[model samples]
Target: MTDTSRRSLLGALGALTVSAAVPPAAATASPARATPSTPAASPSPATAATSGPRSSMTFTGTPYDTAAFARSSLGELTATVLPGTPVRTEIRHGGQRVAVLTKGARTVLLPGPERTFTENKQSFTDVFDRLVPDPALPPAKRLKPGWGTSPSGGTWSVYGGTSGDTDFGVHTKGAATMLLKDTEAGRYATLTDDGISDADVNCVAAFDKVPTGNACSFALLFGYRGGGAHYRARLSFTTKGEVDLRVEKVMNGETTLLAEAGPLATEVRAGDAWRIRVRRKGAKTQVTAWPAAGAEPTRPTAEIEDSEAGLRSGRVGVRGFASPGCTNLPVTLITGRFEVTAANWETPPSVTHRDWVRLLDAPFDGEWTPAVEAIVRGWAGSMAPDVFSYAMMFLPGAPGVRGADPRVAGADVLGEAGYGKPDSQGLRPVGADFHDYLERPWTFPDQTRRPEDGQRGNLDCSGYVRMVYGFHLGVGMMAVKDPAKKALPRKSGAMVDFAPGVRVAQRTGSGGSAPDLGQLQPGDLVLFDVNDVAGDPEDPDAYDVDHVGIYLGLDRAGKRRFLSSRKSADGPTMADVSGASTLDGPGIYADSLHTVHRV
Candidate 1:
């Protein structure tokens, strides 16, 4: 644990934007080259840089900028599921379509429209098959189709594959606990971070969910050599950039909230803990801090502070052990489980087309919406096919759901966005390695904007921030027009220049590398300037403000998550940015955290 100071945090709150420049390669490919801080290479997805299908998805009605792409293959699994219902999902990829209907897992066959119930062929149910048909091979070679069969004309067993980010064809729950192994990574994890090392690991916990927006959480307790060989237990979670909050401890349904390193708030004491009682009273979970536990002499008036994190989430989970920018000593997390309450968990109403659109698009600027919402919203939707599907890593239903907006109201937002699927290499958005991938062509966006903005163009440095938080209605006023745009004494009256609140913080940059160590906060905005104006993590330069990400809590493993606005890793987009893609990464020039604003 670490102790965070107050004054230092306050001084760190500045509202500056960075040059939106990226590396010559990053502008084209967003160069990201980082190594894990944990042992054996296992860390949080916050730091795992890779690419994914840039689907045309709106935020929780609220969320980035990237390129649009040709979504020729962006279909998803759909089921009119009931809460607490159990169902198996089967996906076929590469050249393979759907397997046989009611045969043994191994006795499956290809489907056809004119060819049903005969010739040992599989039964076809969906219409997509009749139109496009299977690739005459395995989808991704993930499953050992036809047993001992290789669609690529090989002798190895071919499993199905994904047109999305995760690959390798085979994914299943491990032994110790319900865990998913990437198969290629040679590591089985609860969070499925693809993190693995030969270091001495003791206990291992099971990752049930990856917080909001696909960022998973898991804990590890292991013994490693850091100064001296000792045993340390730490947690890990995904983060946007820095951090704002951390779940210190959860007991008897009560949780402790701590601002690990906030620019507006004080740092978290190595042993300091905030308590939260989980009793859903109305729209929020009632949480009160600093109560008289036993009998502490007199109740001092030092201001009992408390914070509330949505079960749905504002920025996924707060960054825990890993801050997306930290590379601390090694400490393994072993034997644990993750618990996540869905934000959009109750998704029944949105199950239908009309309800789904209204549930997300909020006050859309245009009539066009997206189809990816039906799938992505599952994380918080009223119904979860099964936590295991995501928590343990399983596939969605096969033959993928088929439907047409026919309304054209939002027909091919995904196709128009150019949301292409990833290769079988399990490509992440961050830099597992800079400038590379395993499949499909990827190009960064020229400009990024709000799909709901009703207008188009890129979001300037500060504008990026205003737009991101703008998703939250009452977050503040700076979300729309700059408060500084107003007259003198522009304090509370203007959302332009936020006075000094207790938590929200920001930073901006225009040149030179970011600041040196001695400075960094959990939820501080990271603005950078890579090529010209400024950018954030998406830039190759030290201070590029053209991008933005949220600060998530850490995990038991201590590997940080760095969420950001990418160039659709695979194509062009409307505003050049959209959706919240949580990848593995860290902050830049820890010192570059310039302007800190607390609101």
Candidate 2:
């Protein structure tokens, strides 16, 4: 695999686009190449290098991106993408399309469709058969028809004349797992990758029936270059109920055992799942296996160093083997999932602020809205899917302020009149309009709101800043009470002057001076002195900063916008309910935009 060859392969793939049209019922002849249904301009070098040479497929969406790999004649390939999901190209041979391919943020060569195995099933119901329909053959005969049966009790169904008689297929249950359909002969399927030398491959699988002897096993394969050439990590159960893990290198059908971990104390029983991991880096290869329900072991179960450079680079795959010595009856192996990750493939991270904004449900130029939602979810330790609501809980009694519960509108304020403080008439101090939650209960002063009530989360301007940078993202924005620290200070006003990530900027006062906007990025923090409280020249450190918000790039009309929790909105918002969250126009908070920080 040379650079010139990889570039040529990508060029061939660049011409193909994923189509939404349903696959043809029968195997179609592999055209010389597929033409784009909707032609677009070629990607520039910059655009082509946006993602790394990494791809993923979850088989969640419709089968796409197969036009480029439809020429595979080794076996049948079929895919099914659930409706309304994004298109992800699937690799399904043997009657099930279980995975899709997704490019990483920095990709150089997108993996092409492969020619391996046959048939595919998906999480979707009603898997359409992609094998050529044989009206003359019965259903059972069609399922495993072949030129002849191999030594094993399996037949090659898709590739009828192939010498191998082992049956290789993935189960169509809850999650797709490649099933070894009771075969003494080893069978494997490979993904199509170009020049992938340093790679990691892993999967979770379990034995359907414990082997009577050592002849049955599940395997992880890498550096596969077709025709039985690759590296394999084999895990098998012994008669003593222990597990045997080993690594082997195969070249053109010749097998050489490299490393072996003789039977281990860990007992393996039928239906007990284990995660097997194998990595090939340069001339060194390592393998590890552990209970799928437990954490992966820190050390490899078996490791071997081979200076053979021919086993340097290729694709990744899976294999299954069973013999008569292991079981008199037929057995099946269930593989829950499979994954491959290529390391050391570097490319630039070029996702733009505008791109992120386009994904948010907010109106034009409102990408920061979802970012804020994501931050809030991080703070709550609950990142599961939910309705986009209640980013921040404002102090009770702020107009329209409420928690996730409609019944919990305001905080339970314990007023000084009700308590022992006779000098103060209200729950908060005099001239202290906004009470910072300070990472404490948002239901402070009264402290009645509990986590179950959903009213206990709250943050003021500075608290929100600290939550985003210091607490959630660990940006070292010192805690609110730690005014003595050298890092970004606790209060909003202090941050405007002494922020660690502070960038030089022109200030726009009440008189409305045009500020420099070129230096700002989307995640930067914008500070404001909305009340002109910074005008107290004598005590600059003690003066208050009115507002702070997360900068969102530019809106549809080209106005710079930000996202923040406000008393007017009673929670986080990017809307114009109180004042537009913009900074450049004639909006209310625009004139108060004084400084910016990019922590």
lDDT of each: 0.21, 0.43
Residue-pair clash count for candidate 2:
24
Candidate 1 lDDT for residue 231: 16
Estimate, for each residue in 1-599, the C-alpha lDDT of model 2 and write its tens digit. 23333233222222111211111222111221121121122221222222222111112133234443233323544534323212223435555332232211000011223211000100011111123123344665453321111110111122111244334432242232334444546655444332445655576777777777545777777766664678888887665668888888888778899988867545667888877776656667667777787776666787788845666765555576775566543556666555543222211111112111111121112122344334322322211111111111111111121122223224211110000111111011111112223212223222332232222234445655554444323334443323433344556777766655435364755555655766554556788867775456786556546677777556554667666655443334444433566887676778777776544
Global CA lDDT of candidate 2, please? Answer: 0.43
TM-score, one value per model:
0.21, 0.33
Q: Single out the weakest 10-residue window by summed lDDT for candidate 2.
A: 117-126
TM value for model 2:
0.33
Q: What is the lDDT of residue 181 in candidate 1?
A: 29
